[model samples]
Target: MKDGDETRQREDTPFYDHPTGGWGSLKSVARWMVKGRPSPGVLDTLRIQNKPGGHMCTSCAWAKPPNPHLAEFCENGAKATIWDLTRDRCTPDFFARHSVTELQGWSDHDLERVGRLTHPMRYDAASDHYLPCNWDEAFAGIGARLRQLDPRSVVFYASGRASLETSYLYQLFARALGHNNLPDSSNMCHETTSVALKSTIGSPVGTCVLSDFEHCEMILFFGQNTGSNSPRFLHPLQQAVRRGCKIVTFNPVRERGLIEFTSPQEPGPMLTGGSTRISDTYLQVRPGGDIAAIAGLCKHLFALDDAGGGVIDRDFIAEHTDGFASFEANIRETGWDGIEAASGLIRADLEAVAEIYARSPRSIGIYGMGLTQHVHGSQSVQMLVNLLLMRGNIGRPGTGISPVRGHSNVQGQRTVGISEKPELVPLDRLAELFGFEPPRDEGRTTVDAVQGLLDGSVRGFVSLGGNFARAIPDQGRSDGAWAGLALNVQIATKLNRSHVLVGDGTWLLPCLVRAEEDRQASGSQTVTMEDSLSHIHGSVGRRAPASGHLLSETAIVAGLAKATLAPNPRLAWDDWVGDYALIRDLIEATYPEEFKDFNARMFTPGGFYRGNPARERQWKTTSGKAGFTTPTVLSALGAEPGDAVFTLMTLRSNDQFNTTIYGFRDRLRGLEGDRMVVLMNPGEMARAGLHEGQRVTLVSAVEDGKTRALPGMRVTGYDLPDGCVAAYYPEANPLVPLGWHDVESKTPAYKGAPVRIVA
Candidate 1:
C-alpha cells in the first residue's frame, strides 16, 4: 500500500451531473428511512406495502403497475421496506454481546445495524459466539447435518429473498432431501439473461411485459445503471421520458438515472422545476467494450440494409428467423477499425446509434450486471438479442429484451424452481407433483458452490437469502472456502457477512422478512412473486414479526422438510406446514402451464402475466424460428489494450443493495468515507502513475493460480472510457478470479476483469 502510505486529502468525491430523481432522490429516501428505524406506523405501512392490491415489491424485479403511481415505491423500494421493516431486534442479548471475533470487527453497514435476527442462533464452538438455538434445536441441527452429509454433500443457497412459496419449498426440500444442490441468486445475475435468451429466443423469459414500458418507440440502455441499480427503475424511465420516448444509454459510467430524471414521485415532474430527459444517446462504452459497442450497432444495421435502406426485416426475416445468412455475414465482417478502437466510439457514433435503431418502429432492449458481468457476458447478451432481432424486436408492440433484475424475487426465484440446472422443469412433473424422485443431478452453481466447497464435494452450506460470503468471488478464496465447510446455514433476516462467515457447524435461522407478517394454518399468508416483467404477484406482509422468533420462509421450508424427511410419507410436512394455500396447491401441481389459476389469479388487480411464448411471436426455437446469433465476439471486442492493463468493472453502489450494505455512502457515485473507491480516467490518471486519492493495489492480470490482491484501493478521477477502471463488487472481489466467467452463462467476469493499478 504505497502511494503515500495511507492517503486521504482527495476526498472531494461528489460529482453529480444533475437530473436523477429530484430532491436528491427525496433526501436519499430520508436517509435510508432514518437509518432503518421505522415507526410513523412503520412508515405508514411502507406506503401500501408493495402496491396495487398491496404487498409485492420486496424490491427490483421491476414490472409492477396493474395500477400504481401513488408512491408505488422507488427510493430503492423505500430502501427495501426500510430494510426489512425496521423496529430493530437482533436479540439473544445481541449474540451474547457480539464475538465471531466480535462480529468480525463490524461494518457491512455495521453488521446490519446490530438488529433483527431475533432468535435461532448456534455456532457456539465454545463461545466463538451465537448461541440460542431451538426450532427444535435448529431443525434437529439441520437434520443431523443433513443426515451426516452427501446428498451431493448438500449446498442449497437460493436468495432473491425467496418466496414463490419459499422458492417452491426450497426446491421441494432440495429434491426431497436427496439433493439437487440448487444454487441461486440466479447463479450470479440473470445467468446471462437466462443463457442468452434461451439460445436466441426460444425463450428463457423477458419477451417484454410491463406494458412494454408504455408503448416504447425506442429505449436501449445496455449494461444498465438507471439510478444506481434500479431506483424504482426511474418511474418507467420517467414515463418513457414523458412519452416522447427515445432513451439510448450504453454505460462506462454516465448513469445519474441515465442523465436526467427527477420523478420524486412525478407530479408534473415533482411540481414543475422539471427534469425528464433521459439519454437520447449517451455512449461512453468501453470496459469490455460491449462487443465493440454492440458490433457497432450491428455494423450500422448492416449498412442500412445493404444501402437499399429498407432497413432489413425483409418480411420479418423471411418469416420468423434463423441464422440470417450467417447473421448477415457476421455483420458484413465488422469493420470501422475494429468498431472505432473497441467502441470508445466514433464512426459517426456508431452511425448515430444505428440511426436510433433505424428510425424506431417500437424498440426496447435494457440490460444489467452491465451486460451480464462480462468476459463477453454471454456474448454481451447475444449483442442484446442481436439488437433486438434487428427490428422485428421479438414479438411486437413496443418490442422486448430486458434483464434489469436486482432481486425482489430474482425473476421469481427462477419461476418457482430456483435452479442450478434442474433440467428446465419436469422430472415427470417433479415426480408427479412432489412425491419424490426429482434430482436428475447437475447442481452447485455460484461457481459450482465454490468448487463444491473446495472439493470435499460441498459438505453442507444452506443460505436461502444471500450474503453468501459477501456475495461471492474469490474473497480471500471465499473466506477460505467458507471456513472449510461442514455445515453452515444462515436463512437470515439481518446480521450478515454470511453470519460472521460461518462454518464448523453454524445455523442462525431467523426468517420472515419481505416486510414481516407471515402466519400459517390458513391465516395471513400470500407469498408468490415473479417480476422482472413476468408478473405473477401476491406479497402481503404488513408489519409485525420482526421477531416472535421469526419463522416462515414457508415455515423454514417446512421445518427443514420435517427434519430431513424422517418418516417422510412422501412429504406432507404437517399439511404443507399448516397451509399456505397448500403451497399454492403444490405450485399448481408443479407448474400446470403457468400455475393455472394459482389462487384465482393472486387476487387480481396487478399480478398475473407470466406468459411469454417469445411474447407471442412464438419462436420456441430448436430451429422452429427466431435465432440469428453470430456476433462471434465482434473480433473478440478488439482485444489489444494491455499497456499496464486496465478494464476493471465491479460496481453497485448508490448506497448499495445486492449484498445489502445500505451505507458506506454512494450518493449515486459521488462516494464517501470509502467502500474502497476507484472510478478512474483522468486520462487514465496521467497514464497510470495515478493521483487523485491515490492509494492503489488491484493487481490480477491472469495467473489463474489465484493470489489476486486488491489492497487499499481508492483512485477517483472519472468520465471513464480510456482503458477503463471502476471498483466495488464484494470489494473488488479479490481482484476477481473464480474462473473469470461467462462462456455461455457461467456469468462472473463481474463486467470484464484484467486489473492492475498498484501504485
Candidate 2:
C-alpha cells in the first residue's frame, strides 16, 4: 500500500483501549519488587539506609546522619534506588549457560533481568565465550594494547561516574601517552551548552547553585522537566513554588514533572497525595524552535527598553557586555511573523511569557537536552544568555542560567580537563609540573571517535563507564563501527549491550560502583563531584565492594598507565597512581589558581565551589565582555506535503536512563508493559488517518533509505504537537541516519526526523 493510504487505513483501526491502572502494571511493579531473593521492603530499607549517610531521604546526595523528619524520596529517585538495589545477579555461571549468539536476540529488559555483573570476563572469540580474567591480566592486556597504539588513535572515554581524581589522571595518562582523545559522554549531550556558555561568558558550567533556586521570584524552565530528569532539584523547585515563585515552561511535550510533582520530602501531605504544581505557564513550542522563542522574548524586551520601561538592564549591558547594538539591530530585523511561525506560538503567548519574565525582580532560566540537542543548540543557549543579560537576571540570589546536568559528575569531569581539545596553557602547565611536553594537537570528540572506528583509525576503545553503543544514535552504524575496532575495553559495574558488541579482542574489567568503598593504595580515597549547580562536593563510598575482584577506577587507570608507559616513560606514572594525593598534586600544579591545595580543599565536608564568572556579571569573552550572538535564520526541515512524512522524535522512557532500561513502563505517561508504542496527538493521528493501537510500519523518508518497521506498536493518542510523533530511543534509533546530527555539536537530532507511517 502507498504510505499515505496505509496511514489512513491504520487510522481507521480501533485503538487498544486499556485502563490506566490495570492489573498488568500492578503485577509488573510487584514482580520488580519481589523478583529476587531480597524482599521488597528489605531492599527499600537497604536503599534508604544506604542513602548518603544513613538518611531516609532518597533524593538529595547530601542526605546526612540525622534523616529529615519527612517523606524524602522523589518519584525518579525511587526508581533509581529500586533499580540499583535490585536483588538479581548475573553470575559467571549465567554467562557459561548462554552463548553469545543466543544472548544477541534477548531484549534489553531480558538482558538486564540477569542483573549486575559478578565478575570480570574477557571475550574469547575462538570459543565464542566470555571467561573470567584476572584484574592484573586485564590491566596488562589493555595497557599493552594502548602502548602499541599511536596513543593519538586510542580514545579514552569517560562517563560522569568517574571521580575528579580519576578523570584528572585519565586525562594525564592520555597526554603523557601523546594523545588527547578524551571523547567523553558530555560531548554527545551538553557540549553545545558548554561551547555556548564558554564563548558567551567564559565559564562553560552553570552559574547557579541549588540554594539559588529558592531565591527566585520567577523561573523560566525551557526544554527541561526537573521532576523526571533531575529529581534532586525538585525540592528546591517545590520550595520555590511554595514561596510564591512563578514558574514557566517551554517544551513540546507536557512532561509530568512540569505539571505536578509530589516532593517525597514532605511528610503528611505526600502520604495524603498532596503535590506541588510546577508550572504557572506552560508553552508548548515546536521541536528545534527554542531559538525563536528566546528571540521573541528578546524582541519584546528590546521594545520595552526603547519605550523607557527599564525592562533591559542598561548599566549591566554597557559595562559587562558587547555587541548590544548589533544584537538590537538583528532583533529589530527579525519580524514577528517569522518568530511566531518558527516558535509555533502566537505573539500574545510570547508577550504573556515576556510579561512574567519582565515583571519578576529576580528570575532564572533552567534547561536540559531539549534545548541543546538541536542544529542551532548552542545559539539557542546563547539567546537565553542574551535574554538573561538584558534583564540582569544573573549573578544574584535565585537568578541565573542553570542547565540541569543528567549525570552526577558530568560538570566535574569537564572541570578537571576531560576534553578532546586541551588548552595550551594547561598543557604547558602540565609539562612544567610533570616534566613532559603534553600533546599539542586537538583530539577526537565522541563523533570523531565513532568516525575513527569506522575508518579503521581507532585501534583500541576504552570506556571508563557507560553503554556507548546503545546510547549513540544510528544504532546499526554504531554497531558496525564498534565491530570494526581492534580491541574493546570496558571498565564497568554491569553487563551491557556494548560489551557483547565487541571487536576481535574484548575485555570487561569489573570496577567498583559509586555505592561501594574504594580502598586505594593511598588509604580510603574520597572522590569529588561537581553537581549541576557547580558545587564540588566529596562523594565517599560507604559500603563494601560489590565483589572483591572489582578495582577502583583510579587504581585501574594507574595500573594501565604503569604497564603501558613502562617502555617509554617521560614521567613517572606508577608513583602518581600509588597515591591519589599525587594525582591531586599534579592537578594543583597544573591548575594552581583553580585547584589550589586540592588535597586540603577535598578534606572539607562540603568540598568547594568552582569559579563562576556570571556571579559577578563578569564576561570573559574575547572583548572582555559578554557578546550577543545572533543566530542565522534557521531553515525548516519539515517534510513536503507530497512526501507523506511525519516528524518522529525519540524520547527516554520513564523507567530508563539513556539506553539502560529499568523497566518496560512509563508510569507518569500511563504507558505500561511496552516501550515500542508510538505516541501521537489525537488530532495528528486523525489528520494522518491513523487510529489508536494500529500495528503500522514507520519508514524514514530521509534520503538514507533506511526503514524501521516496529510491528505491533499500539498507536496511543497523546498531547504531542501536530505533525509530530514520539517513540522510545534505541528501539527507534534505526530510523535516524548516521549522518543526521547537529552540525555545530554533532549531537544526534533524535527529536526531529522525517518519517512516513505505513501498514
lDDT of candidate 2 over 457-541, digit per residue (tens): 9888889988877777667666766666767888876777777886576888877665566776667766666667665555556
Best of the candidates, lDDT: 1
| Residue pairs with clashing backbones, model 2 | 11-689, 11-690, 11-691, 71-264, 71-265
What TM-score number comes out for model 2? 0.90
Pairs in steric clash, model 1: 61-532, 90-116, 99-102, 373-751
What RMSD does model 1 have? 23.4
- Which lDDT tens digits does candidate 1 get at residues 711-759? 7887888666788688888788777777877777776777677777779
Specify the highest-TM-score model's number.
2
